[model samples]
Target: MATSVNRSCLTYLLHLAQDNLDFRLPEIKALLALRGKSFHPSGDFQEKTPFWCLDGLAEEDVRGVMARSVCAKSAFELWGHGQTHSELRTSLLNYPSENMSPFMHKDSTYRINVYTFNKTLEFPDRIKRIDAMDYLPFEGTVSLKSPQHIFCLLEDYGTDPNDIPEHPNYIYFGRWIADGQRELIRSHSVKNRHFIGNTSMDAGLSFIMANHAKVNENDLVFDPFVGTGSLLVACSHFRAYVCGTDIDYNTIHGRGRSSRKNQKWRGPDENIRANLRQYGTEEMYIDVMISDASKPVWREAPLFDAIITDPPYGIRESTRRTGSHKDVTKHADGIYLESHVPVSQAYHLSDIFTDLLNFSAHHLVVGGRLVYWLPVYRPEYSEETVPLHPCLRILSNCEQTLSSHTSRRLITMEKIRKPEELDGLAQFADGRFSPYQGHNAFREKYFSGLNKRCIKEDNKAVVNGQ
Candidate 1:
């Protein structure tokens, strides 16, 4: 009863990686939501900082989040924290004895680690910092090799690197729980993957998107513009059943020219399924087909648990769908030879998002999520520019800057209710709701200083080659 009482009052501290400052909070919150918990910060929360103190979470909850997060480095059961060492000592001494006794018993073995953020410490200085903690009642044996329990003393010298302070701005001491999945970023890097494409999503961002979608084991996830199956690979890592559709027949069949260097053509067995096999998740692979996103192929029912994709922005890859504007007289008897091929025309950016939201509203289960990327021209971008639908509610919008004037926002939305006739008509009810209307216009804005005609011709040649 005493242990439970002490644990309930305890606050946990998270040591996060400094990169991707905008994404860490949502990732942690979504992971906590999976375990039926809410984010409760203990103090003034600063999103850009490396340390976050959270309240109302058990050790198991912390461990669960650490197991999956790539943005966080480690989590700790915070014992004490303060702006100065003297204050920290007072806080530590004031902590309940019952909470510390369990891990500090004389029969146990433990290790202490000193971590400094935005600063470096010499070996002797690190040892001095550890020695300064002699006031704590640590009766356990010190084992540096393999300890049964680990504790950490973390110091934050502030985020600015140029101005070095004589003392740390903040300090925290806690019992370490678990480290996050940062290793996955390195292990699944696109440079090392067996199959890849020019616009393959980065490994870290792929996992981050999966988390934002709340992907889980046994869930059905779909990607509309699944180039090289990078997003599928991330979902499969989380044990979700993955499938996708792409308009590019060459990509779907894994044929034609290769995206890899020093390779002329793709080899047999060099496809999405093989990529999953390389990651030991081949069983999660459902299928990848050659189909246009502008057209509907699925039945009229809620099927997917999540819809996650990265649509082409006409910057690195051309956006084309199955259709032609030129009037074509029907063949005699409406029959064509087997050698005939379907013609493709430019797919507008606005129409792509309109069809996407409508498709998601009809195809995603209630409470399901839809995650995708929206390219934006920085000067004109605003919340109103995001595409909207009646059945879907906006959850998060995180930006990844590509250039001085261009960025892509990762937009996540949830299906609140089933679609209705009235709902479809009311999608643009908001006067401010405006979607991207043309790929050429966006491309022109993206490449304002360059020769527009030459760029368009170059893009046409590249598409023709593919």
Candidate 2:
């Protein structure tokens, strides 16, 4: 079912003891298959398989099989994945204890790639089983006494009988990462498809969360103002149907490029003419229309599992549009969003952030999540917190300022079943004495306090009878 090159891809799932050994199996299997590794030897393609984690390298390399494994050790591991598994093996055979102690060893023979399909795999602990072999000592000053790496071999006698060169008794987890996986990831890469300079977000953060969001095969994902179609591409990586919309012409063109059977691209980026040549999207055209944000709507569709986007925050792209006949130029006041690349037409989208949020929520499935990024800065304090949605339970003494760009808050929220969940919409007037107010003392009192006018009283998330 796969080309020989891909079939030979050595897929391995390294897990530590007590970790959720089988937790990521299904997703991993799907990801690999989506990536194009549908022909693994593991059969039935079960996850939670255990593999040996060596203790010779750094802990960061060891944690890479886990989510938070992006530490210094993992940096080396990712490097290792592409080349030199044998060199690392040789080092382990010799200096088993350099960081942990001193790695010293002697010549040894035989190298094995193992997979643990049944139980938990922990390094050093399970490695004790090797005691019976009296394996050669680790060479030189780096001895086994202090080992920095950790690992878990799947089983004792599991081996893949193949003509692969170098070592025997070598095992493989599945196959190399699938081609489909790369394409899927690439399709959503913020860097690859960055059509709008400052108006787009990458697939990195969403990809990370999708790994933890507990999604299923048929769930749907939505991205309003879907700049360059990054979120939709990432969602498809998880096998979820994607629905994206945007207001730009190029964005619409790029999104519409692929009209193939493998995909069902819907909304603004729906140019089936170009897409069919490259992918497997549907013949049923994805409906993308140019509607005003203040008044937006989509042909009736199913509710969505998540709402993911990064909207303009007035600062990066000033919400103010300036025109002098010949050409128009706009600017954001340095909104300090770390990954944000400011766009030119920002001035045209000011304070409309609320409208965007309201429209996005209108489509989210109850209990579904809404993830977005915003920029917020407090003049009194230095440094800004990013991805701020996780910490909000209530609002108080909040000042809304047009972004001069110090902090762009990333707001991610879920569409709860009831309005009481987030108090609907709450407003804040800048107090004259407030930090945002600067020195205007007379305006402080009236500008401050609970904003009761914007609160929605209906069971619905908001109200706009029209």
Candidate 3:
């Protein structure tokens, strides 16, 4: 049996994970946007808070959001909420009889659970809290082992550990709906993955990036700086056709030293395609190639539905691209050998982003997304440092702190217009479209900080020994 669904207006509660606080809002909004809807909060909501009460959503809409959200832990149909226990009782009393009657039938089986945030309670204390909810006319028989209906009494004790409140700051009672796909983190852990590399992305963040890109079935996703195809693995899980290009021939061919401990060399079939096969998404594997990002090989047409990549940060991998100032030795008729290995030159951080934005502007379908990481020297970073293009609009930028002084931001941009003939050349001529000067010096700043840390550690060790 189902109650009348007011599709346009209903309140739902989302219990989000505490970590990745910066990514929660964008993830939810992106998911909602996929459904042709927008996020509408009912109360004074804080983005960092664990609980968010959203209006303008039905149970199905909440379930849909949870289906793709890694930041959300669970969601529920909000029956009632209040600032205090007495207020909660009054709120519960005001809930419509018809709305509360469905799950409280005399013949139904039900259970009530007590959950507290930022505080722990004894078993008896938890029992007492559940007993206090007896004021609700739950005519159903209690079932501890297996319940037909599960209701939760959630209490918020505030986020501070030092100043614990004796009473909850807020309370919510709701019917448990669905849980997010957070298990994907543990299941797709890089430590247990079949093929990985020195800078293989963590599985959780890869899924986050995929979600931010709004990748869906049959979508063609490309990673320009694919190292061991971590982003491709994440996209393939969503049933997207995945392909990539990397400057490192060894990475493209999977014919080099192993990244795993105790392994001398990479084994046969140890490649990106094999990774998809291991996860049973081999059919989604498009071909990967050895190519420089600076000199793209794709035709001048909108091809990729989404471009998701993590360009080298010069920490774990050397950032180099093919070509040198020295003239190439020419054979008869100015011919170069097919097997010739061109000398690689330092690919500046600024040029990498400029070329990427230009390539995405030309290759991405309108409304398609481009998601990539931008390494930052924390002190010098600002909104201006992010690369820009006239045809692409920046959607969201979330930072993941790596150290005290270094962080990498996940920048998501959506292509809004087709590239004009001048679009490619405009980025070079226009100073506004160019990357901020600070970004150009990231490589130098990164090493300076690293060297300082090493020196500080050495000094600390010497003093401790003395």
Number of clashes recorded per candidate: 0, 85, 0
Question: In candidate 2, what are the lDDT values of residues 1-466, reduced to their tens digit?
Answer: 3443332332233432323232233333322333333323322332322333222322322222233221011111211221233543443454313221221233322232233333334666445534422343434332244433322222322223243334223332111111112233345554534232444444444453354333335667666656545555455544567666655544566544333334454445344223321334333223444333454566433267766666544433323222234442333773555543333332233234445545544556665666555444344323222211221221111122433323333344555443333434233232221122221221122223112222433423444452
How would you encode candidate 1's per-residue C-alpha lDDT over 9-59 as one tens digit per residue? Answer: 679999999887778888898899988999999888888899999999888
User: Alpha carbon lDDT of residue 442, candidate 1?
Assistant: 77
Q: Number of the top candidate by lDDT? A: 1
Per-residue error for 127 in candidate 3, Å, reads 0.8
lDDT by residue (tens digit), candidate 3, 17-116: 8998888888898889878889899879888889999998777788888888889998988888999988999998997777788889999999988889
Name the better of 2 and 3 by TM-score: 3
For model 1, the run of ten residues with the poorest summed lDDT: 431-440
Q: Which model is ahead, 2 or 3, in terms of lDDT?
A: 3
- My TM-score estimates for the predictions, one after another, are 0.94, 0.40, 0.95
Model 2 segments beyond 4 Å from truth? 1-200, 209-216, 253-285, 296-302, 314-350, 378-410, 420-466
Q: Deviation in angstroms for 225 in model 3?
A: 1.1
Pairs that collide, model 3: none
Candidate number that wins on TM-score, 1 or 2: 1
**Which stretches in model 3 have alpha-carbon errors above 4 Å?**
1-8, 331-338, 425-430, 461-465
In terms of lDDT, model 2 sits at 0.38
